[model samples]
Target: MEVGQVLHMNAGTGETSYSNNSHLQKKVISMTLPIIEEAMTNLYSSTSPSSLVIADLGCSSGHNSLFVVSELIKIVEKLRQKSGHQSPEIQVLLNDLPGNDFNTMFKSLPSFQKNLSSQLEAKDAGPYFFSGVPGSFYGRLFMKKSLHFLHSSYCLHWLSQVPEQIENNKTNIYIASTSPPNVLKAYYSQFQRDFSTFLKCRAEEMITGGRMVLTFIGRKSEDPTNKEAPNSMWELLAMALNDMVSKGVIREEQMDSFNIPVYTPSLSEVKSELLEEGSFSIDRLEFSEISSSTYYNEYNHSDVSEIAANSIRAVAEPLLVNHFGDGIIEEVICRYKEILLGHISQEIIPGITNLIISVTKK
Candidate 1:
């Protein structure tokens, strides 16, 4: 499947919406805050361009998107005031797929503007502007030498499109223990192509000293089929789908053919890709684990499984809907919740190890 057109977080502020259920992603953004701050600090101090151009690739819907812009604004404005220099024109560009819920995101800008006015002083404030660019970051999204800093959190693990010729890996949505050798190669190859293109595109668009901070789910081991691999949530999802098939809720072929365009690479794989591209110097590489229990804290329930499943639903529902139709969404989520309950109870689900990397254009 073409991810750019179909892959998006569940929209709106409903119970199952990404906007309401994005605490996990917010956690990721917060964990990478120090890296983002440091990069912004360095970019602002060294270049001090007349216009500070910034782009947040894969800026999905909801508060998490605006929260990033707010932080960048505060950081730059503070640096300007401290140096006693006239503020640079800060133009923030938010990029995501065309299918993203930009309307819901744009609707919240009024409050974002109001909050920004309260947070920063109006004195000598350079005019800051924001424009949404709907496109895939796997290719170029801006003019050459235009961007000063780039930030993307909880993205990049998704391939530009689903891997081809994985027909043998039936019933497994991603790289699972049961997947064949060909399936593994297909996923990694697609990631290499997609990530290499991403780096090349960004290198062309960003200035010489520009820095980018990227945070995404990655595995610790070189093995892609580890029991607790970064994308195990999808494995549990596959179990649910198979159960549905047995119950005649969905056809066996429907479940067997469905595969998400997500690939959680090992740290070594990421390093290899970056080395091959050679567009950016690696400044920092670190991984931190965030608990699945911590990802859900809305109603204060002890059932961590359902909470975790709900979080997964917010992110995966759209993709499922695009593939299987929306009629089975409720059933799939519920079955997935039950499957997760058993899975979480039987074993301690390891929290996802989020990889945070800061790189500078060479």
Candidate 2:
């Protein structure tokens, strides 16, 4: 399914802003830049490269896109300047689902470019270029051995499609409690398969020794025993969907077919996949759990509660609309808001319940 086309409208929480995400990105980049520099150096072994191609996979709309891409370029430019080599032209590719809000991304590009241009003018850096490659990163987006550096944050783990078993099981059981034993198996199996494909695709697209840094959410549990295990946040999300279903806001069938496309990988799992894809060696790997508090911060009193609920809706409403039908969406979203607010105000602080895993490719 397309990114926001199927399950949740904003399944990836793609609406997250750069300001809210600065801390996470900063942390990931600190661990990633060195790895990228080393890989790029290896890739350009004998030649003095003129332009650096940095692709940000799973790049969503809003300021985060501009923020991350600009940051990546700045780092690369700084490195080249220090090395006394004329900076290579920068080619930045922003990727996301086919249906992503390109208007926001496109509109922001000029400003991003203007900022980069100003910086280059300051350092006597050469002209830099930027573009958007709209497609799923689970598949190839570039020609063989083309990209010099690739950066993906909180994006690599999304499977290209929901597991077929889960999709087919819609009529067999309720969406809430319905996933067959094979749902997660199918999901993980596809993840391994798609991830292997992604690695292979990147291996093909990235020049040998090219630099690729990836940061994504991971599960604390080694692996889920089944599709419904507590370790899978998708399960909690599914529960939220079921609640909507119970309230007649969604169809049982819709719930069955809808699934969040994200899959959190364990550190070991990622290492194994990277190795299987071949040619890439992990230069660095760091995993840290972050607070989920970011989820609740968007709302203030009514607005805060409104968005805290809407944030989940941003992800879920799309799915409900796709499967259950759009008519129930507003109702579902409203109910979702009320329920989430009640829980947060009454039960728990909105916090991140995820681990960040950053990997450097050879």
Candidate 3:
């Protein structure tokens, strides 16, 4: 059986998590991939056979994998055709959490391999390879000079571990747990550690001129001094949880146990970090509001319900099931959805998101 199942939510009736927002995903991909492809073409001269390896870190199961994989293969084929070189031995790696549904990812591989092989065979191009490397992206995964191009979409910003302070607390003392000073500091420190690790790994894994294109959620400001407001998304999420607690859908004590497993980096912060690592040069940085048209936005009964349900399945439901207990998930999700539906809209979405930062190795 596939490790993951297709979303059965009907969008109109249930809650939605942000991950199931297909419109958001598509918009981010469209804005980022072109710049990445352009950079790859410029960095790698197509005149000669080049061994190329491309990796997608934090590639979760289901639709995310499907879209990213298709994009990677398409760009690689384009590069090969444009360069008129024998296709390099292609290596694509997908990394994610241990609990991530690799079964769904594996099931999709056969078709991908068959199709790519047939295309390469038709063109008499060199062989292509596909593999899944399952693990956290906070550490190294390859040998020196092993990669030609690297990409990570919507994943790098997550800290390796939730802050110990928040995790250790028995009561809900933090105003907004996700952005607690201690938590943010811990997440930033982890970002520093993991990012440095990423650069060190890439320096060893990438050729001198290899390219890397990364897209992740980023804050617009460089200021660590900014305070989160009550209307902030993080706070809104806190409100939703509070409502669930009041309804007895979830334990009030569990609130402290639930923190978003992510940290949003600012542009200045990213640039400073990249330079510190000295592994790559910034090529382009793009940021924009994701379009809602890419989603099932008709707001009709069935579509809305489906989208909402999928959202819960994609993020909230899974996290609750993992952290709190599966037994309370359905009821918790029901209450959480009620809170979210009251606040979350395609508009008024807090946080400046969809950051695409492209860099080339020195």
Model 3 vs. true fold: TM: 0.80
Q: Give the candidate number with the greatest lDDT.
A: 1
- Lowest lDDT 10-residue stretch of candidate 1: 293-302
The better candidate by lDDT, 2 or 3, is 3
Residue pairs with colliding backbones in model 1 are: none
lDDT of 1 by residue, 292-339 (tens): 555543443336776677788988888898888999988998888887
Which regions in candidate 1 have their CA more than 4 angstroms from the true location? Answer: 293-303
Q: What TM-score goes with each of the models?
A: 0.96, 0.79, 0.80
Q: Over the stretch 1-362, how does candidate 2's per-residue lDDT look in tens digits?
A: 55534421242324433323334444555545555555555555545577777788877665466666676666656667667777677777777777666666677767777777876645666566667787766678888878877778766655676666566655332222454667657767877988898888888888655677677766555644323212333444455567877877566776666665656666778778777876677666656544445433544656665654544555445555655666766665565566556655664542332333333445
lDDT of 3 by residue, 73-115 (tens): 6666677787666666667777666666667668877886677
lDDT of 2 at 278: 69
- Measured on C-alpha atoms, candidate 2 has an lDDT of 0.60
C-alpha local distance difference test of each model: 0.86, 0.60, 0.61
